[model samples]
Target: MTYTFDIIGVTPIPKFVQFQHQFAKKPDRSKTYLGSYECSLDGLISATKMIPHKPNWDWDQVLEEIINFWVQSEESIQHWKKQLYTVREESLLVARVANSEALRQEFETLWQE
Candidate 1:
């Protein structure tokens, strides 16, 4: 999977079309937000079925990809200061919602650190 990074506060505008309008007002800079969004090249994917995401998808690999991308591309490390991990319980929530006992345990173990 390809990953892209956006440095908050460095650019007045964000690259993603979805974020461009939302960040227009410049919400609280101190708060950290992490999320995933879906867009289709062809219209069929979204029309056909809901995208199934694993409980730890964002917590594990996705977060690392985002951080790595930013680290490699950004000139200054300061932009990463506000990037925060989405709480560990969120992973447990996703696991419970997906009804995956193993995923729940994985999150529990990771959360202990």
Candidate 2:
């Protein structure tokens, strides 16, 4: 199973930063599990405007560092549970904003101003 979260509007650009954590079996015959992760950014831009894609941070490097640390660190069920909660919270926040008609109108108004 994979867990996903999005951090929206945390940067200058109007974009959704998606984070995914993937799980799979290790290549060795140890019958152990391993994790791989990835992140993507989708911009919420106006159709009339064209802007080059850029991010201030090195997202790939940050993701690599985080995954490396997670894989190397000793973890228990509690740690994973905490991570699940974090994912849930971020996911909920994204959902809330995406589903809010009022928020959408507000952004539209701001953009038109």
Candidate 3:
């Protein structure tokens, strides 16, 4: 079974569709806000079934794809700072949620640090 989750803020580098094939298959990958300088895409979707997420998903992968997207994109890094991207870091939490309740507690404990 597929679960739905939000890919908080996904915007285009240009005024129109960027179609970052990296996340193309993701369902409802639609543009949201458009300003004088940038465009955005936002959605909650059935991740695996809708989009082709890279496998062997490690915590580093999260930092790479989602976090590093704007950081490495010289042109966009500034935008990330301006927006004040605030997301709950839940990398280990996800795995813990499935492993065991105790593990989940441990995940949160580690995260709080």
Candidate 4:
């Protein structure tokens, strides 16, 4: 079964970031699992924004880089249990893009002040 990523609880402040892996075909809430990676708001913004600029990189490679970033930044890599967390490359890419765009808007407002 295919799976996708869902980003939740994102805020303007640097706080705990939570994401989930869920069956793509099934929208049921019960079919999903949650996972978290400790990262600063800046790190999250940078990683998600930077990946899209590399035109040569494929989605799989991009996903690998993101996974590596999470692992390296987190002290306990065990949190990334395979069964609970799986990255659907495209879904993550889309989520990151959307996230970055929202961040961009937020930042623009701050900058304009």
Candidate 5:
């Protein structure tokens, strides 16, 4: 599928970069939601700097790099999912342990009283 990228913002810092993938064929042109990447002020500035010397630069290479940096790979998504799951499991275990410890302390206090 073909896609287009748009930089959304008016101020010195752009809000984000939006990309839309073309899903429908021509004559019934339609775009589907791809994703957006929040742009940092420094990144925007650096990107602009690359544009000035464009005549001598490889535009295709530049586009490829930008897309690669913005797009999330399947492996990256899976890795992030695993990391989140591990964090959540650890947090739940810690909470359960803390709750049991608190209950034990309460029982001891009551028995002593």
Candidate 6:
């Protein structure tokens, strides 16, 4: 289930900015949420990048492609959404020292610019 997206990037992407504003400093949030959101956006961008610069694909195909993307993902967002469900299981009430350490390391390495 683990993947490359699990690791923070060396440079923060544009989506990460919005992710921070909405999900970063909130009662219901975690690095996994940000990571999942980033991956989802990345998938969209990556998909679009595959198309030729011109109108290689019609509008309907593009829309179909977008819908197919999530449908193809058997796991869907449940992987992360479920994590958000059980606040206790997610360690929402307590400080996750280990996770914080990893997240800090991620920010330091990724946001250095």
- C-alpha RMSD by candidate, in order: 18.4, 17.9, 15.3, 14.0, 23.8, 14.2
Show the colliding residue pairs in model 5: none
Q: Could you tell me how far off, in angstroms, the CA of residue 87 lies in candidate 4 after the best superposition?
A: 23
Candidate 4 residue lDDT tens string, 16-95: 12222222333322222222343333334444443312322234544554555555645333333331245332122222
Q: List the residue pairs that clash in candidate 3.
A: 10-41
- Give me the runs in candidate 1 sitting further than 4 Å from their true place: 10-58, 78-113
Lowest-sum lDDT 10-residue window in model 3: 90-99
Q: How close is candidate 2 to the true structure, as a TM-score?
A: 0.23
How many clashes does each candidate structure show, in the order listed? Answer: 0, 0, 1, 0, 0, 0
Give the number of the best model, judged by lDDT: 6
Q: What does candidate 5's lDDT look like per residue over 75-100, in tens digits?
A: 54344335434542221100000123
Give the per-residue lDDT of model 6 (tens digit) for 2-107. 1112222322335544544454444322233222223353444343433222222244444454455446654644453444344342121111111344456667
List the candidate numbers ranked by lDDT, top first.
6, 4, 5, 1, 3, 2
- Model 6 has an lDDT value of 0.36
Candidate 6 — which pairs collide? Answer: none
* Candidate 3, 1-113: lDDT as tens digits: 11112123433334123433533344332222111222222111112223243332332333334333433455554444345334232111010001133335657888899
Q: Point out the worst 10-residue segment of candidate 6 by lDDT.
A: 89-98
Q: Can you write out model 1's per-residue Cα lDDT over 54-113, one digit (the tens) per residue?
A: 222333343444446544754433323322223322211000011234435657888899
Q: Which candidate do you rate higher for TM-score, 3 or 5?
A: 5
- TM per prediction: 0.24, 0.23, 0.20, 0.24, 0.21, 0.24
Q: Global lDDT of each model? A: 0.30, 0.27, 0.30, 0.34, 0.31, 0.36
Worst 10 residues of 2 by lDDT: 28-37
